[model samples]
Target: MMSFNATLRLAACLSGALFVNAACADQLDDIKKAGKIRIAVAMGTPLFSYLDEKLQPIGSDVETAALLAKDLGVQFEMVSVTNAARIPTLQANKADIVVADLSITPEREKVIDFSRPYAALTIIVAAPKGTVVKDYADLNGKKVGLTRATVNDTMTTQLAKGAEIQRYEDDATLITSVVTGQVDAFSSTPSNLGEVMKRAPQKNWERKFDQKDFLLGIALNKEQPRLKAWINTWVEAKLKDGTLGAIYKKYHGRDLPANVVQL
Candidate 1:
Protein backbone atom coordinates (compact mmCIF):
# COMPACT_ATOMS: atom_id res chain seq x y z
CA MET A 1 0.00 0.00 0.00
CA MET A 2 1.15 3.57 -0.59
CA SER A 3 2.50 5.38 2.42
CA PHE A 4 0.12 7.85 4.14
CA ASN A 5 2.21 10.90 3.11
CA ALA A 6 2.49 9.79 -0.55
CA THR A 7 -1.25 9.16 -0.77
CA LEU A 8 -1.95 12.57 0.77
CA ARG A 9 0.42 14.26 -1.69
CA LEU A 10 -1.20 12.50 -4.64
CA ALA A 11 -4.65 13.53 -3.47
CA ALA A 12 -3.48 17.13 -3.11
CA CYS A 13 -2.06 17.15 -6.64
CA LEU A 14 -5.32 15.78 -8.06
CA SER A 15 -7.32 18.41 -6.17
CA GLY A 16 -5.06 21.15 -7.47
CA ALA A 17 -5.59 19.95 -11.04
CA LEU A 18 -9.38 19.94 -10.52
CA PHE A 19 -9.23 23.46 -9.07
CA VAL A 20 -7.27 24.71 -12.05
CA ASN A 21 -9.77 23.17 -14.43
CA ALA A 22 -12.69 24.72 -12.56
CA ALA A 23 -11.37 28.27 -12.66
CA CYS A 24 -13.74 30.47 -14.68
CA ALA A 25 -15.77 27.30 -15.38
CA ASP A 26 -18.85 28.60 -13.59
CA GLN A 27 -19.02 32.04 -15.23
CA LEU A 28 -22.72 31.81 -16.14
CA ASP A 29 -23.65 30.25 -12.85
CA ASP A 30 -21.77 32.86 -10.87
CA ILE A 31 -23.43 35.74 -12.72
CA LYS A 32 -26.87 34.24 -12.24
CA LYS A 33 -26.17 33.67 -8.59
CA ALA A 34 -24.96 37.24 -8.15
CA GLY A 35 -28.01 38.60 -9.94
CA LYS A 36 -25.92 41.11 -11.84
CA ILE A 37 -23.80 41.24 -14.99
CA ARG A 38 -20.84 43.56 -14.81
CA ILE A 39 -19.97 45.21 -18.13
CA ALA A 40 -16.84 47.22 -18.75
CA VAL A 41 -17.37 50.18 -21.11
CA ALA A 42 -15.56 53.23 -22.41
CA MET A 43 -16.70 56.21 -20.34
CA GLY A 44 -15.46 58.98 -22.63
CA THR A 45 -16.43 57.91 -26.14
CA PRO A 46 -19.61 59.64 -27.18
CA LEU A 47 -22.43 57.65 -28.82
CA PHE A 48 -20.87 54.50 -27.46
CA SER A 49 -20.50 54.80 -23.66
CA TYR A 50 -20.27 58.17 -21.98
CA LEU A 51 -21.79 60.24 -19.19
CA ASP A 52 -24.70 62.54 -19.87
CA GLU A 53 -25.24 66.00 -18.37
CA LYS A 54 -26.57 64.27 -15.28
CA LEU A 55 -23.28 62.29 -15.12
CA GLN A 56 -25.23 59.10 -15.56
CA PRO A 57 -23.89 56.44 -17.88
CA ILE A 58 -25.83 56.93 -21.09
CA GLY A 59 -24.91 55.73 -24.58
CA SER A 60 -25.42 52.93 -27.06
CA ASP A 61 -23.11 50.48 -25.29
CA VAL A 62 -24.69 51.30 -21.96
CA GLU A 63 -28.15 50.75 -23.37
CA THR A 64 -27.11 47.52 -25.07
CA ALA A 65 -25.54 46.15 -21.90
CA ALA A 66 -28.68 47.07 -19.95
CA LEU A 67 -30.85 45.19 -22.41
CA LEU A 68 -28.51 42.22 -22.21
CA ALA A 69 -28.79 42.05 -18.45
CA LYS A 70 -32.55 42.41 -18.65
CA ASP A 71 -32.82 39.45 -20.99
CA LEU A 72 -30.61 37.45 -18.65
CA GLY A 73 -32.84 38.39 -15.72
CA VAL A 74 -30.05 40.18 -13.91
CA GLN A 75 -29.13 43.68 -12.84
CA PHE A 76 -26.81 45.71 -15.05
CA GLU A 77 -23.57 46.85 -13.43
CA MET A 78 -21.55 49.30 -15.46
CA VAL A 79 -17.80 49.39 -14.93
CA SER A 80 -16.09 52.31 -16.59
CA VAL A 81 -13.02 51.25 -18.52
CA THR A 82 -10.62 52.73 -21.07
CA ASN A 83 -9.56 51.49 -24.49
CA ALA A 84 -6.51 49.71 -23.09
CA ALA A 85 -8.37 48.38 -20.07
CA ARG A 86 -11.26 46.63 -21.80
CA ILE A 87 -9.71 43.20 -22.19
CA PRO A 88 -7.74 43.47 -18.97
CA THR A 89 -10.93 44.11 -16.99
CA LEU A 90 -12.41 40.87 -18.25
CA GLN A 91 -9.13 39.06 -17.70
CA ALA A 92 -8.94 40.26 -14.12
CA ASN A 93 -12.48 39.05 -13.40
CA LYS A 94 -13.59 42.60 -12.66
CA ALA A 95 -16.16 42.56 -15.46
CA ASP A 96 -18.25 39.78 -16.91
CA ILE A 97 -18.31 41.32 -20.38
CA VAL A 98 -16.77 44.26 -22.19
CA VAL A 99 -18.96 46.52 -24.37
CA ALA A 100 -16.41 49.25 -24.91
CA ASP A 101 -16.41 49.43 -28.68
CA LEU A 102 -13.95 46.53 -28.81
CA SER A 103 -13.21 45.63 -32.41
CA ILE A 104 -12.69 42.00 -33.20
CA THR A 105 -9.25 41.29 -34.64
CA PRO A 106 -7.03 38.26 -35.10
CA GLU A 107 -4.47 39.48 -32.52
CA ARG A 108 -7.06 40.23 -29.83
CA GLU A 109 -8.78 36.90 -30.45
CA LYS A 110 -5.70 35.15 -29.11
CA VAL A 111 -6.21 36.85 -25.75
CA ILE A 112 -10.01 36.92 -25.35
CA ASP A 113 -13.02 35.46 -27.07
CA PHE A 114 -15.65 37.72 -28.66
CA SER A 115 -19.39 37.47 -29.09
CA ARG A 116 -20.69 37.64 -32.65
CA PRO A 117 -20.36 41.26 -33.70
CA TYR A 118 -23.25 43.37 -32.48
CA ALA A 119 -22.17 46.61 -34.15
CA ALA A 120 -19.84 48.10 -36.75
CA LEU A 121 -17.38 50.99 -36.70
CA THR A 122 -16.16 53.31 -39.44
CA ILE A 123 -12.90 55.11 -38.78
CA ILE A 124 -12.23 58.39 -40.56
CA VAL A 125 -9.36 60.79 -41.05
CA ALA A 126 -10.28 64.41 -40.40
CA ALA A 127 -8.25 67.54 -40.96
CA PRO A 128 -8.74 71.28 -40.72
CA LYS A 129 -10.23 72.99 -43.78
CA GLY A 130 -7.75 74.41 -46.33
CA THR A 131 -5.28 71.78 -45.14
CA VAL A 132 -5.19 70.04 -48.53
CA VAL A 133 -5.19 66.59 -46.97
CA LYS A 134 -7.18 64.58 -49.49
CA ASP A 135 -6.17 61.08 -48.54
CA TYR A 136 -3.97 58.89 -46.32
CA ALA A 137 -0.96 59.78 -48.49
CA ASP A 138 -1.54 63.43 -47.61
CA LEU A 139 -1.04 62.60 -43.92
CA ASN A 140 2.64 61.94 -44.55
CA GLY A 141 4.87 64.47 -42.74
CA LYS A 142 1.74 65.93 -41.01
CA LYS A 143 1.09 65.70 -37.29
CA VAL A 144 -1.94 63.44 -36.79
CA GLY A 145 -3.52 62.82 -33.40
CA LEU A 146 -5.37 59.66 -32.39
CA THR A 147 -6.17 57.69 -29.28
CA ARG A 148 -3.14 55.63 -28.39
CA ALA A 149 -3.31 51.87 -28.88
CA THR A 150 -6.61 51.97 -30.75
CA VAL A 151 -7.35 50.41 -34.10
CA ASN A 152 -7.37 53.95 -35.48
CA ASP A 153 -3.83 54.42 -34.28
CA THR A 154 -2.84 51.07 -35.72
CA MET A 155 -4.25 51.87 -39.14
CA THR A 156 -2.91 55.42 -39.16
CA THR A 157 0.55 54.09 -38.39
CA GLN A 158 0.29 51.74 -41.33
CA LEU A 159 -1.27 54.17 -43.82
CA ALA A 160 0.57 57.34 -42.81
CA LYS A 161 3.97 55.72 -42.57
CA GLY A 162 5.88 59.01 -42.83
CA ALA A 163 3.40 61.02 -40.70
CA GLU A 164 4.12 62.36 -37.24
CA ILE A 165 1.56 60.27 -35.36
CA GLN A 166 0.82 61.82 -31.97
CA ARG A 167 -0.97 59.51 -29.56
CA TYR A 168 -3.33 60.75 -26.83
CA GLU A 169 -4.86 58.89 -23.93
CA ASP A 170 -8.54 59.40 -24.80
CA ASP A 171 -11.04 60.97 -27.20
CA ALA A 172 -11.34 64.20 -25.21
CA THR A 173 -7.62 64.82 -25.52
CA LEU A 174 -7.68 63.94 -29.20
CA ILE A 175 -10.48 66.42 -29.87
CA THR A 176 -8.63 69.07 -27.93
CA SER A 177 -5.50 68.40 -29.94
CA VAL A 178 -7.29 69.00 -33.25
CA VAL A 179 -9.28 71.99 -32.03
CA THR A 180 -6.22 73.71 -30.60
CA GLY A 181 -4.10 72.85 -33.62
CA GLN A 182 -1.85 70.87 -31.32
CA VAL A 183 -1.88 68.46 -34.24
CA ASP A 184 -2.78 69.11 -37.88
CA ALA A 185 -5.69 66.65 -37.75
CA PHE A 186 -7.13 63.72 -35.82
CA SER A 187 -8.24 60.21 -36.70
CA SER A 188 -11.49 59.08 -35.08
CA THR A 189 -14.83 57.53 -35.72
CA PRO A 190 -17.44 59.75 -37.39
CA SER A 191 -19.76 59.41 -34.41
CA ASN A 192 -17.05 60.74 -32.10
CA LEU A 193 -16.21 63.63 -34.44
CA GLY A 194 -19.91 64.47 -34.64
CA GLU A 195 -20.16 64.60 -30.88
CA VAL A 196 -17.09 66.85 -30.72
CA MET A 197 -18.61 69.17 -33.30
CA LYS A 198 -21.79 69.40 -31.24
CA ARG A 199 -19.71 70.68 -28.34
CA ALA A 200 -16.94 72.57 -30.14
CA PRO A 201 -18.45 73.25 -33.61
CA GLN A 202 -15.10 73.67 -35.35
CA LYS A 203 -16.41 74.00 -38.89
CA ASN A 204 -12.82 74.21 -40.16
CA TRP A 205 -12.42 70.45 -39.57
CA GLU A 206 -13.51 68.09 -42.36
CA ARG A 207 -13.12 64.43 -43.05
CA LYS A 208 -10.21 63.65 -45.33
CA PHE A 209 -10.77 59.95 -45.89
CA ASP A 210 -12.74 56.92 -44.76
CA GLN A 211 -10.28 54.46 -43.24
CA LYS A 212 -12.14 51.14 -42.92
CA ASP A 213 -15.20 49.47 -41.48
CA PHE A 214 -14.62 46.97 -38.68
CA LEU A 215 -16.91 44.65 -36.74
CA LEU A 216 -17.35 45.42 -33.05
CA GLY A 217 -18.15 42.72 -30.53
CA ILE A 218 -18.44 42.23 -26.80
CA ALA A 219 -15.23 40.95 -25.22
CA LEU A 220 -15.33 38.16 -22.68
CA ASN A 221 -12.92 35.90 -20.85
CA LYS A 222 -11.60 33.11 -23.02
CA GLU A 223 -12.45 30.59 -20.34
CA GLN A 224 -16.18 31.38 -20.63
CA PRO A 225 -17.04 29.62 -23.87
CA ARG A 226 -20.61 28.95 -22.73
CA LEU A 227 -21.13 32.61 -21.91
CA LYS A 228 -19.60 33.59 -25.24
CA ALA A 229 -21.98 31.24 -27.10
CA TRP A 230 -25.00 32.57 -25.21
CA ILE A 231 -24.06 36.18 -25.99
CA ASN A 232 -23.61 35.36 -29.68
CA THR A 233 -27.15 33.94 -29.78
CA TRP A 234 -28.46 36.99 -27.98
CA VAL A 235 -26.70 39.32 -30.43
CA GLU A 236 -28.13 37.40 -33.39
CA ALA A 237 -31.63 37.82 -32.00
CA LYS A 238 -31.11 41.53 -31.40
CA LEU A 239 -29.80 42.07 -34.93
CA LYS A 240 -32.73 40.18 -36.51
CA ASP A 241 -35.35 42.07 -34.53
CA GLY A 242 -33.74 45.44 -35.32
CA THR A 243 -33.10 46.09 -31.64
CA LEU A 244 -29.39 46.70 -32.19
CA GLY A 245 -29.88 49.23 -34.98
CA ALA A 246 -32.66 50.95 -33.06
CA ILE A 247 -30.32 51.61 -30.16
CA TYR A 248 -27.49 52.56 -32.52
CA LYS A 249 -29.67 55.10 -34.31
CA LYS A 250 -30.98 56.51 -31.05
CA TYR A 251 -27.45 57.46 -29.96
CA HIS A 252 -25.71 57.89 -33.31
CA GLY A 253 -28.54 59.89 -34.98
CA ARG A 254 -28.47 57.66 -38.08
CA ASP A 255 -29.52 54.20 -39.10
CA LEU A 256 -26.84 51.51 -38.92
CA PRO A 257 -25.68 50.68 -42.41
CA ALA A 258 -27.47 47.49 -43.50
CA ASN A 259 -24.26 45.96 -44.80
CA VAL A 260 -22.66 46.12 -41.35
CA VAL A 261 -25.70 45.01 -39.35
CA GLN A 262 -25.39 41.22 -39.42
CA LEU A 263 -23.02 38.54 -38.12
Candidate 2:
Protein backbone atom coordinates (compact mmCIF):
# COMPACT_ATOMS: atom_id res chain seq x y z
CA MET A 1 0.00 0.00 0.00
CA MET A 2 2.84 2.42 0.72
CA SER A 3 4.79 3.99 -2.14
CA PHE A 4 8.47 3.01 -2.51
CA ASN A 5 9.92 6.43 -1.51
CA ALA A 6 7.59 6.67 1.49
CA THR A 7 8.65 3.22 2.68
CA LEU A 8 12.30 4.27 2.38
CA ARG A 9 11.62 7.42 4.42
CA LEU A 10 9.87 5.42 7.16
CA ALA A 11 12.77 2.95 7.32
CA ALA A 12 15.25 5.81 7.54
CA CYS A 13 13.34 7.38 10.42
CA LEU A 14 13.23 4.10 12.37
CA SER A 15 16.93 3.52 11.80
CA GLY A 16 17.74 7.00 13.05
CA ALA A 17 15.71 6.45 16.21
CA LEU A 18 17.46 3.14 16.87
CA PHE A 19 20.87 4.72 16.36
CA VAL A 20 20.05 7.49 18.82
CA ASN A 21 18.87 5.01 21.39
CA ALA A 22 22.01 2.95 21.08
CA ALA A 23 24.16 6.06 21.39
CA CYS A 24 22.31 7.03 24.55
CA ALA A 25 22.49 3.60 26.13
CA ASP A 26 22.71 3.51 29.95
CA GLN A 27 26.24 4.14 31.20
CA LEU A 28 25.86 1.72 34.11
CA ASP A 29 25.61 -1.24 31.75
CA ASP A 30 28.69 -0.04 29.96
CA ILE A 31 30.58 0.13 33.25
CA LYS A 32 29.50 -3.38 34.14
CA LYS A 33 30.50 -4.71 30.75
CA ALA A 34 33.89 -3.06 31.02
CA GLY A 35 34.62 -5.00 34.24
CA LYS A 36 35.88 -1.94 36.06
CA ILE A 37 34.76 1.33 37.60
CA ARG A 38 36.89 4.43 37.49
CA ILE A 39 36.42 6.63 40.52
CA ALA A 40 37.79 10.13 40.77
CA VAL A 41 39.45 10.94 44.09
CA ALA A 42 40.90 14.21 45.22
CA MET A 43 43.99 13.04 47.03
CA GLY A 44 45.95 15.12 49.54
CA THR A 45 42.66 15.89 51.26
CA PRO A 46 43.26 14.32 54.66
CA LEU A 47 40.40 12.30 56.18
CA PHE A 48 38.83 12.15 52.73
CA SER A 49 41.41 10.84 50.22
CA TYR A 50 45.16 10.87 50.76
CA LEU A 51 48.32 8.87 50.26
CA ASP A 52 49.42 6.38 52.88
CA GLU A 53 52.95 5.66 54.13
CA LYS A 54 53.51 3.31 51.22
CA LEU A 55 52.33 5.99 48.73
CA GLN A 56 49.20 3.97 48.10
CA PRO A 57 45.87 5.75 48.16
CA ILE A 58 43.95 5.24 51.40
CA GLY A 59 41.21 7.23 53.07
CA SER A 60 37.47 7.44 53.41
CA ASP A 61 36.86 8.17 49.77
CA VAL A 62 39.31 5.53 48.65
CA GLU A 63 37.64 2.91 50.81
CA THR A 64 34.17 3.98 49.69
CA ALA A 65 35.17 3.77 46.04
CA ALA A 66 36.66 0.33 46.58
CA LEU A 67 33.47 -0.80 48.26
CA LEU A 68 31.40 0.39 45.34
CA ALA A 69 33.57 -1.50 42.88
CA LYS A 70 33.46 -4.60 45.05
CA ASP A 71 29.70 -4.49 45.21
CA LEU A 72 29.53 -4.14 41.47
CA GLY A 73 31.93 -7.07 41.04
CA VAL A 74 34.36 -4.94 39.11
CA GLN A 75 37.94 -3.82 39.34
CA PHE A 76 38.58 -0.48 41.05
CA GLU A 77 40.48 2.20 39.22
CA MET A 78 41.43 5.32 41.08
CA VAL A 79 41.63 8.50 39.06
CA SER A 80 43.53 11.00 41.15
CA VAL A 81 42.47 14.60 40.73
CA THR A 82 42.98 17.96 42.35
CA ASN A 83 40.17 19.70 44.24
CA ALA A 84 39.23 21.78 41.19
CA ALA A 85 39.32 18.77 38.86
CA ARG A 86 36.72 16.54 40.54
CA ILE A 87 33.71 17.67 38.51
CA PRO A 88 35.68 18.29 35.37
CA THR A 89 37.19 14.81 35.48
CA LEU A 90 33.73 13.25 35.61
CA GLN A 91 32.52 15.50 32.82
CA ALA A 92 35.47 14.56 30.69
CA ASN A 93 34.82 10.84 31.13
CA LYS A 94 38.19 10.32 32.74
CA ALA A 95 36.32 8.79 35.65
CA ASP A 96 33.04 6.96 35.85
CA ILE A 97 32.11 8.47 39.22
CA VAL A 98 33.51 10.76 41.88
CA VAL A 99 33.78 9.65 45.51
CA ALA A 100 35.72 12.74 46.45
CA ASP A 101 34.37 14.92 49.25
CA LEU A 102 31.98 16.66 46.90
CA SER A 103 29.58 19.03 48.65
CA ILE A 104 26.03 19.21 47.37
CA THR A 105 25.32 22.71 46.16
CA PRO A 106 22.64 24.05 43.86
CA GLU A 107 25.23 25.34 41.41
CA ARG A 108 27.00 21.95 41.24
CA GLU A 109 23.70 20.08 40.98
CA LYS A 110 23.03 21.85 37.73
CA VAL A 111 26.01 20.08 36.13
CA ILE A 112 26.15 16.68 37.85
CA ASP A 113 23.88 14.18 39.58
CA PHE A 114 24.48 13.42 43.26
CA SER A 115 23.58 10.56 45.59
CA ARG A 116 21.87 11.33 48.90
CA PRO A 117 24.05 12.62 51.73
CA TYR A 118 26.56 9.99 52.78
CA ALA A 119 28.78 12.28 54.83
CA ALA A 120 29.11 15.83 56.18
CA LEU A 121 31.79 18.48 56.58
CA THR A 122 31.85 21.59 58.71
CA ILE A 123 33.75 24.56 57.30
CA ILE A 124 35.47 26.93 59.67
CA VAL A 125 37.92 29.78 59.75
CA ALA A 126 41.07 28.83 61.63
CA ALA A 127 43.87 31.08 62.82
CA PRO A 128 46.62 31.18 65.38
CA LYS A 129 45.16 31.88 68.83
CA GLY A 130 46.73 35.30 68.83
CA THR A 131 45.20 36.35 65.48
CA VAL A 132 41.82 37.38 66.98
CA VAL A 133 39.52 36.47 64.07
CA LYS A 134 36.18 36.01 65.81
CA ASP A 135 34.00 36.90 62.81
CA TYR A 136 34.04 37.72 59.11
CA ALA A 137 34.63 41.35 59.93
CA ASP A 138 37.75 40.37 61.81
CA LEU A 139 39.28 38.96 58.61
CA ASN A 140 39.31 42.37 56.97
CA GLY A 141 42.75 43.15 55.53
CA LYS A 142 44.02 39.76 56.72
CA LYS A 143 45.28 37.11 54.34
CA VAL A 144 43.02 34.05 54.26
CA GLY A 145 44.01 30.83 52.52
CA LEU A 146 41.77 28.04 51.23
CA THR A 147 41.85 25.20 48.72
CA ARG A 148 40.44 26.40 45.44
CA ALA A 149 37.04 25.08 44.31
CA THR A 150 36.15 23.83 47.80
CA VAL A 151 33.18 24.80 49.98
CA ASN A 152 35.66 26.65 52.16
CA ASP A 153 36.65 28.74 49.15
CA THR A 154 33.03 29.43 48.29
CA MET A 155 32.07 30.43 51.83
CA THR A 156 35.11 32.62 52.32
CA THR A 157 34.67 34.25 48.93
CA GLN A 158 31.05 35.06 49.66
CA LEU A 159 31.33 36.15 53.32
CA ALA A 160 34.89 37.33 53.90
CA LYS A 161 34.47 40.37 51.67
CA GLY A 162 37.38 42.52 52.83
CA ALA A 163 39.82 39.64 53.42
CA GLU A 164 42.63 38.99 50.97
CA ILE A 165 41.73 35.51 49.76
CA GLN A 166 44.61 33.24 48.74
CA ARG A 167 43.73 30.10 46.86
CA TYR A 168 45.86 26.92 47.03
CA GLU A 169 45.62 24.06 44.56
CA ASP A 170 45.43 21.43 47.31
CA ASP A 171 45.10 20.93 51.06
CA ALA A 172 48.78 20.13 51.56
CA THR A 173 49.79 23.40 49.93
CA LEU A 174 47.31 25.37 52.00
CA ILE A 175 48.58 23.76 55.18
CA THR A 176 52.16 24.49 54.18
CA SER A 177 51.27 28.13 53.48
CA VAL A 178 49.88 28.45 56.98
CA VAL A 179 52.94 26.81 58.52
CA THR A 180 55.31 29.12 56.64
CA GLY A 181 53.33 32.25 57.56
CA GLN A 182 52.02 32.73 54.03
CA VAL A 183 48.53 33.31 55.37
CA ASP A 184 47.17 35.05 58.42
CA ALA A 185 44.31 32.54 58.60
CA PHE A 186 42.79 29.71 56.59
CA SER A 187 39.36 28.27 55.97
CA SER A 188 39.11 24.51 56.44
CA THR A 189 37.44 21.71 58.35
CA PRO A 190 38.23 21.10 62.02
CA SER A 191 40.07 17.89 61.16
CA ASN A 192 42.22 19.77 58.66
CA LEU A 193 43.02 22.43 61.24
CA GLY A 194 43.90 19.68 63.67
CA GLU A 195 46.52 18.43 61.20
CA VAL A 196 47.93 21.91 61.00
CA MET A 197 48.04 22.11 64.79
CA LYS A 198 50.02 18.87 64.88
CA ARG A 199 52.60 20.53 62.68
CA ALA A 200 52.81 23.70 64.75
CA PRO A 201 51.53 23.11 68.26
CA GLN A 202 53.02 26.30 69.66
CA LYS A 203 50.84 28.45 67.40
CA ASN A 204 47.77 26.97 69.14
CA TRP A 205 45.59 27.19 66.05
CA GLU A 206 41.87 27.34 66.81
CA ARG A 207 38.67 27.78 64.88
CA LYS A 208 37.80 31.46 64.74
CA PHE A 209 34.23 30.92 63.53
CA ASP A 210 32.12 28.23 61.99
CA GLN A 211 31.28 28.97 58.38
CA LYS A 212 28.78 26.27 57.38
CA ASP A 213 28.14 22.56 57.50
CA PHE A 214 27.65 20.85 54.12
CA LEU A 215 26.26 17.47 53.12
CA LEU A 216 28.75 15.54 50.98
CA GLY A 217 27.58 13.23 48.22
CA ILE A 218 28.92 10.97 45.53
CA ALA A 219 28.86 12.59 42.08
CA LEU A 220 28.39 11.30 38.57
CA ASN A 221 27.34 12.54 35.16
CA LYS A 222 23.84 13.98 34.94
CA GLU A 223 22.68 11.53 32.28
CA GLN A 224 23.16 8.30 34.29
CA PRO A 225 19.74 7.89 35.85
CA ARG A 226 20.24 4.20 36.56
CA LEU A 227 23.66 4.72 38.12
CA LYS A 228 22.40 7.62 40.20
CA ALA A 229 19.47 5.57 41.51
CA TRP A 230 21.72 2.60 42.27
CA ILE A 231 24.21 4.81 44.12
CA ASN A 232 21.40 6.32 46.19
CA THR A 233 20.12 2.90 47.18
CA TRP A 234 23.66 1.72 47.96
CA VAL A 235 24.30 4.78 50.14
CA GLU A 236 21.09 4.14 52.09
CA ALA A 237 22.06 0.54 52.66
CA LYS A 238 25.56 1.46 53.81
CA LEU A 239 24.17 4.04 56.21
CA LYS A 240 21.72 1.58 57.76
CA ASP A 241 24.35 -1.13 58.13
CA GLY A 242 26.67 1.29 59.95
CA THR A 243 29.35 0.64 57.33
CA LEU A 244 29.65 4.31 56.45
CA GLY A 245 29.63 5.34 60.11
CA ALA A 246 32.44 2.93 60.91
CA ILE A 247 34.53 4.29 58.06
CA TYR A 248 33.93 7.84 59.25
CA LYS A 249 34.91 6.95 62.80
CA LYS A 250 38.01 5.08 61.70
CA TYR A 251 39.45 8.15 60.01
CA HIS A 252 37.66 11.12 61.56
CA GLY A 253 37.64 9.86 65.16
CA ARG A 254 33.89 10.51 65.44
CA ASP A 255 30.67 8.88 64.35
CA LEU A 256 28.77 10.31 61.43
CA PRO A 257 26.23 12.91 62.42
CA ALA A 258 22.76 11.57 63.17
CA ASN A 259 21.26 13.69 60.41
CA VAL A 260 23.71 12.28 57.87
CA VAL A 261 23.13 8.66 58.93
CA GLN A 262 19.37 9.18 59.09
CA LEU A 263 19.30 10.60 55.60
- Model 1 Cα lDDT, one tens digit per residue, 14-122: 4675544444345877899899999998878878887888989898999999999999999999998878778878899999999988888888888887888888889
lDDT of each: 0.81, 0.87
**Tens-place lDDT digits, model 2, residues 1-263:** 23364344445444676554443356788898999999999999988888889998988889999998999899999999999999999999999999999999999998887899999989999998888888999999999999999988988899989999999999988988988889999999887898899999888888889998899999988766557767888999999999998998899999998889876
Tell me which residue pairs clash in candidate 2: none
Stretches of candidate 2 off by over 4 Å are: 1-24
Residue 260's lDDT within candidate 1 is 56
Best by lDDT: 2
Instruction: Compute the lDDT for candidate 2.
Output: 0.87
Task: Report RMSD for candidate 2.
Answer: 7.4
Candidate 2 lDDT at 59 equals 87
